[model samples]
Target: MLSRVANNLIWMNRYMERGYSVLNLLKVNYSAHQDSPDLFPWTPIINNYCGSDSGFSSENSIECINHMIFNLDNQNSIINLVTRSRENARSVQEHIPRELWLGINSYYLYLTKPELPNKLYQEDPVVFLDRLLNHQLLYYGKIDITQERGSAYYFMDIGKFLERVIQISDLASMKLKEIAKTSDALERSFLWKNFLLSIGAYQLYLKKYKSTFQEDFIIKLIFQEQLFPKSLYYCVNKLSRHINQLIQTNELVNNDLEFLLGKLQSTIQYTTIESINEQGLTNFIASIKNDITNISLSINNVYFSNQS
Candidate 1:
């Protein structure tokens, strides 16, 4: 496969995964705002997801949500992401399945509807977001059912897992930063609940940790629980498997990438809640995020350098 095609495939999946995660964050944050209006501020979310230059430094909830969802100028907005995802897929249409392309194109067209912004602003926000979320689910379903398990599949799968891990880390880190500011047990539990729900892990958290929301255990679940698909350990493990398959089948000679991935996998696998506390949660998360960034750069340098 051409490097450009591979790059497009990876970026296409990354945008799709990122847009879905952001939608979840927006929906959960909206609920959190209603549940604890004083505690849940939109400024931090804006800064974290949208760049600092997004010009929405102030917290106008409706305005922020609208901008994040519809503003093409905001590069990280859902509309922009879906647009980019479709563009990337279009560039490599032959490499992907027909159904997948149509699904992506349909998603892009849905976002283009002028009434969406007004609907989200005027009507029930959850319903509006859920409709888009369901669209994403259908798109992903098409990818899984239609795409063959070939090199293209591996590339896209890697993109999906990589983007997921990055998002999990960012969301967990943001919640942890907020958690650090307050010592109130009740507030901490609320924050943790919001965090879990943001990543669609709340029910599993309740099932596995029947005890009152223990902070350490929640951290453990998100960081290393292999059963949880969105956990850092699980995503990294899947990323390693996909990369390994690519290596074996393609006979790619990229030692730096393999080494970086192996190191990251080992770090996540060996990390414990106790150790995380010892290292300080903020510092520990920073390290993991840094490693993930390095891995991303290594992949670009090795596989996609030929582009441009």
Candidate 2:
């Protein structure tokens, strides 16, 4: 595959996944803020996840939701992400199947419509977010069904799960940071549940843990659960496998990517939650984020463009 084609395919899916991550974060936590406006102040979450809650009319739910979804100036907004995703896909249109291309383009067109912002804040916020969320599902499902299982397929999958690994870790860190500030048990559970729902892991979490929601158990579930698709461990392992496949195909000798991936997986496997507690969750997650950033840079250096 051409490097440009591979890069576009990779980035197209990365932006899509990222957009979904942000929108889903809002989706899972929105109703609670709506129900109890005072008991729960949502500014911390907005500030932590969406950068800052500034420039909006108010930090209320509608305004905050608008900021995350419709503020084109915010580089990470859903519309920007979908736009980037489609543009990248456009760069490699020949490589993409017809149905997948149509699906992505259709979603992008829906988001770019001028009425979206008003519809979100005035008519119904959940419906707008859900429509976007469902679009993500449909686009990915089209990819699974239509795209051939080949190098292009592997590259796009790598992009999705690579972003997944980072997002899963980062969201956990953010929710845990919020959880630490609260004294009430109910609030702790609410934050934890939101974390699971954001990643579409709530039911799987319930089936596995059943009775316990301890910090240790939840950390283990997030970081170490091999069977769960959204776990950090699972994403890392899958990413390593995809990169290995790419290396063989491209005939490239890049040790940095493999070594970092191995070290990350080993740390997650051997380190216990007790040891993580000693380091503290904030510091621990910060280290994970740093490591993942380094790995991403190394991969970009070697494979995508401007090869070292």
Candidate 3:
């Protein structure tokens, strides 16, 4: 329950979650364009997300892969994310299970290899990204069976969902903006499905619902589907539960954290697709982004800010 441990847990998961999401973005764009122009959409997106434009403008897909996979300048790069996540895992090694700690260390070691950039560039970057994502997903799968289901687990869960919710929201926002400007219906349809696919929700969506692709359907699926783990609703619900667990375990008396998450989750739960259509996707997604930021700040204030 120490602030240091909590901070490390949140950050370790944040970096890893963001790393996986970025890899997903790379996979989506590279898979779409690898055969023809070799250029990828991630350079601009990464440059925008990381707020640094030093090497992104001229970098082709392969060069951008080098920067994203191994560059030290980009803090959001996989190597740095793995490095920082592993460092935080090291800090809490004794608290978490050996399997989880070893997993983090092994991932870091894999990224630190000298041949990674060459392999990423030469051997189908999307394949490499997919493999890395599977490895990361495998690593996360070990947590539930191995790690203790106490405050530590709750802390890590909060970290994972918090980062995930934000990433999906941002990507969804980007896709919505792109979709809004498209003149062709076919392109809009593709963009709508692409948005779902980016977050790993496409197949489940296809199997579950038989609706034709529309912006509202995709947005509703991403935001309203409680069954989909990657959806905004699911993430928020999971986050609120973890927060409740933390409250019970620590006997913390913070009410604002509960209130903030409660309001957000309730809005997601009660609002129907009709209401979301009326409110507008851009506005709805933007408000959720703001609420998540506020919740994160509130968490810091309540649990970590005052710890000495």
Best by lDDT: 1
Candidate 1 vs candidate 3: the lDDT winner is 1
Q: Candidate 2 residues 17-52, lDDT tens each?
A: 888888888877687677666544567656665566
Q: Per-residue lDDT of 104-209 in model 3, one digit per residue for the tens? A: 8888888888877778757977688877897688678888789888888888888899999999988887776666676878777676776777889889878877
Where does candidate 2 clash, by residue pair? none
TM-score of 2: 0.92
- Output candidate 3 Cα RMSD: 2.6
Off by over 4 Å in 2: 38-40, 53-57, 305-308
Assess candidate 1 and give its TM-score to the true structure.
0.96
Please give the lDDT score at residue 280 for candidate 3.
89
List TM-score per model, in order: 0.96, 0.92, 0.93
Give the local distance difference test score of model 3: 0.79
